[model samples]
Each structure stands twice: as structure tokens, then as C-alpha cells.
Target: MTKLDDIDRAIVIATQGGLPLVADPYGAVADALGLSAEVVIARLDAMQQDGVVRRIGVVPNHYALGYRFNGMTVWDVADDHVEEAGRRLCATGVVSHCYQRPRLLPDWPYNIFAMIHARDEAAATALVERLATALGPLARGHRVLFSTRILKKTGLRLGRQQGGGTPCSG
Candidate 1:
């Protein structure tokens, strides 16, 4: 794994909310980091190449974007094919996130979770069907839980917080 120092990690945390909308976003980040714009850009490029950072893009609120109907489709896939099937699901544009998670005994044990978003519940359901069909019999069982509300959606902060970095007014 590519090791990131404190400065690099700080950069990552600061930019996670989304790059500045201004003409020179990198420059803004550089200003915040007290480094030259060129250095910030170069470091970000290197971080991408090293797999430390995925694509730096906006994470829009799906509901605001007209994708009010979003669901978490959990699947009980065969252990052997879970990885491949999850990858296939992730490859689809409709799948916002796809990963293999552990099952929780009696109540829930679906190993696969894919975030499916659409304009409506019907569309989201249809997309789930398509994904199941693509997986064929590998997808033995599945369930779709549409999100009725967004309790929290925020970027993660790495490193230790001194409790005085950014003040919250409200």
C-alpha cells in the first residue's frame, strides 16, 4: 500500500467534500495547504496513480438530482462467485456502490450490497431484476430496501482532530 504522510492525508480529507468550483480548484487546495499549486496537483496525480485516491468528483445528492428512489439491494450470492458477481454489478452505471459484506445470521445475511438509484421505485426494481438476471442462478436470494430518508451523508475525516481546526457555528 502507498503510505501517505500527515500532510497528504490532510489534503485528502480537505478535498473529499468536492474540489472547489472555481476555475483553479487545485490552486485553492494548494492555498489551503500552504503549498504551491503545482505541488498539490502533482501529489494528487501521484495519489491517483498509487490507488490512494479514486476519482475526485462531485457526489451529488441523488434526491436533488431527481433520483429520489434509491435502494440498497442485498443479495445472498454463492460464496465462490460473490466477488465476480459483485464486480459485475459494480460495473453497471446504476450501481453507486457494490461490495461483499458478511451476513448477520437469522435476520440478515446477504453477502452483497449494491446501492441502486433511479427516478422511481419501479425503475429501481427493474434495475435490480436486470442485475439478478445478469448474475443468473448465482443470485439465489435478494432484497431491496428503498431509502425513505437520508440520515447522514458526509465526507470522512482522517487523522486525529485537535478539536480546534474547523469551528462549527450551529
Candidate 2:
């Protein structure tokens, strides 16, 4: 495991929930943490290289953007073709994310899951049809499971700052 310095820990804590939504997010974080924007960026970059940080990405709120219906389109893809099928689905610009999972026998057989967002149930159904056609021979079967509610989305975070001071404290 990568041992985090105080400053690194602070950076993680500051960003774990999400980056500050501002013109200059890093600068905002640095201003709050008593550090420079460059320092925060450098630290985050180093932490990512060291595997302390995996990925930094946007978590779009589709519902707020008029995409009220979000469906998890599970695909029963042939093991050999799953990778290619997933790549193709992602390339279609319909899927927000796609991943492969272990299939359970008998009751559950889906191995590939992709998420799609639409404005309504009809749109969702249309997207499912489009995706099914896209999958073609690779997918044996599929299901569209709509999300009933929102779930908390957060990143890695520490408990809290131990004491109030510059995160550079050693």
C-alpha cells in the first residue's frame, strides 16, 4: 500500500466526495487546504501514478439533465465475444458504461452489463432495442432493469482531518 503523507491524505479527503464545482476546482481545493494549485495537481498526479488514486472522472446526473430513465441493460454475451461486444456498445455512444461480470447459472445468465439513460420508458425501450440490434449474434439474451432510486456515489475518503494546520505537516 502507498503510505500517504498528511498533504496527500488532505487531498484525498478534499476530493473524495467530489471535486469542488468551480471555474478552477484544483485552485479552490488548494486555497482551502493552504496549498498551491500546482502542488495539489502534482500530488494528485503522483498519487495516481502510485495507485493511491485510480481514476478521476465525471459523474453526470442524468435525471437533472432530462434523462429520467436509467436502465441497466444486462447482456448474456458469449464469453469469447463479450469484450468486443462491450467495446462496440460503448462506441455506439448509447452506453454510459459497460463491464463484464461472472454469470450465475440457471436463474441468472447475464455476464455483460451496460447502463443507458433516456428521457422516458419509451425512450429506454427504444434504446434497448437499438442496443440489442447492435449486440447481434454476440448476445443470446438481455434484460433492461430500470433504477428505482438514486444511490450515493462517493470516492475514497479519510475519516477527518486530525488537527487544523497546513497539510504539509510532517
Top model number, TM-score: 2
Candidate 2: clashing pairs of residues = none
Q: Write the per-residue lDDT of candidate 2 for residues 1-170, one digit (tens) a residue.
A: 56787888889888998999899999999999999999999999998999979988898888788888999999999899988999889988999889999999989999999999999989999999989889898889999899988787775447685753343323
Task: Give the per-residue lDDT digits (tens) of candidate 1, residues 29-58.
Answer: 999889888988888888998987877776
The TM-score that candidate 2 achieves is 0.90
The lDDT for every candidate, in the order shown, is: 0.82, 0.88
**lDDT for model 2:** 0.88
Model 1 poorest ten-residue lDDT run: 160-169
**Local error of candidate 1 at 127, Å?**
0.8
Question: Distance (Å) between predicted and true CA of 104, model 2?
Answer: 1.1
RMSD of each: 5.2, 4.6
Candidate 2's displacement at residue 140, Å, is: 0.7
